[model samples]
Target: MSLRIEQVGPASSARLAAIHATGFDRPWPANEIASLLHMPASLALAAYDGDEMGGFVLVRSAVDEAEILTIAVHPDLRRSGAGRALLDAMADVLVRTGVTRVFLEVSTANTAARALYDRAGFRQIGQRHGYYADGTDALVLEKTLQGSGQDGA
Candidate 1:
């Protein structure tokens, strides 16, 4: 089945945490996700097939800007268009909410994610040294939304 994107709340925190644990060594706990979901600016979107989760993307907005807090696809679902779908879905939300610019940080070692963002029109503007616990640098990418995103899937 194809993945479907849906807005989620604090109730989905445990499930999100499970998926997050698969992607990150220092994954946020369920309580942390729950607390973020309770914030006024936070938005969470889950990609699911029927009731099974494929991935999730979480972001927070302030004024005309937004930042992607996290985005992950199940290991089994990688390269299945899940990440692009979530990104496109998020762009729609940000556009509707009048967000003009979106930003995200991805580890320089995460080539797949960097490629994805490149395809989506995010350009690297700077770098954060030793941003990850493993001493990996992070690429700070930003995309200026002009009514839509490039390669929105």
Candidate 2:
């Protein structure tokens, strides 16, 4: 599949919300995502296969830190790298903004998501009990960015 990541704009909110609802139980309302785009220090990206929206990621930046608000792949496209593509795109944005670390909270029951985060170099930091509206626990994960110097030329 030819997947491409594009920054999501207010006009895409309706489609973005539909993708989110299809992928997860707790989906953001269209207006919620639309509002995020107008916020300073926030970035939202949507992954697409041609004209079809496949996945998306929302993130917020603060100083040297960034936090992922949401990441979801369309149910039919899960395990097809759409999620990873969206994630990598967001990471690129964070790196460009000088973010030294990024964090996110995922449902404990989302093993697939956890595995993806693990492969992306995220380390589990802690857990929040009953963090979800459905009473699911959340696992907090963090990835520290390596300085350019640390990458070794």
Candidate 3:
């Protein structure tokens, strides 16, 4: 089914946390998700199939840069386009805010997620060892906004 993307609001935190719990190896607590609402320049977009949240992407923007704090899709609904839709929605929001680039780190073992970021034009710029609680390294990926990159690629 097609999903609708919404800008996450105060009432959406519980649902976003639920989606994250269902998708992650170690999920953030509901309160932690709620706290994001208070962070300056933070924005979240949630994807819904009817009344149910299917995925979400959280971004924190500053100056010319933005970082994707999290992106998660319900396990059963993955491999569909929900994740990409959420990312695109967040990117659009960032663009309007004058963000010139975005960065995020993905667990090295999350091949599917890495593939999605790569397909969306993100390139690995570096890595962090033992970045996850389980000791998995994280690959830092970055994507420049169109017309914002120095190389203009």
Number of the top TM-score candidate: 1
Model 1 error, position 94 (Å): 0.6
Clashes of 3: 0
| Rank ordering of all candidates by TM-score, starting from the highest | 1, 3, 2
**Model 1 segments more than 4 A misplaced:** 149-153
Output the better candidate (2/3) by lDDT: 3
Predicted candidate 3 versus true structure: per-residue lDDT over 43-152, tens digit per residue: 88988888888899988889989999999999878989998888777777777778889999999999999999987778999999999999999999998885423212
lDDT of 1 at 106: 98
lDDT of 1 by residue, 1-153 (tens): 688999999999999999999888899999999999999999999999878997999999999999999998889888988898999899889888988889999999999999999987889999999999999999999988867654322
By lDDT, the candidates rank as: 1, 3, 2
Best by lDDT: 1
lDDT comparison, 1 vs 3, better candidate: 1
Give each prediction's root-mean-square deviation over alpha carbons: 2.0, 2.6, 2.3
Cα distance off (Å), candidate 1, residue 35 = 0.6
Report lDDT (CA) for all predictions.
Answer: 0.91, 0.84, 0.85
The TM-scores, one per candidate, come to 0.95, 0.92, 0.93
Candidate 2 lDDT trough over 10 residues, lowest sum = 144-153
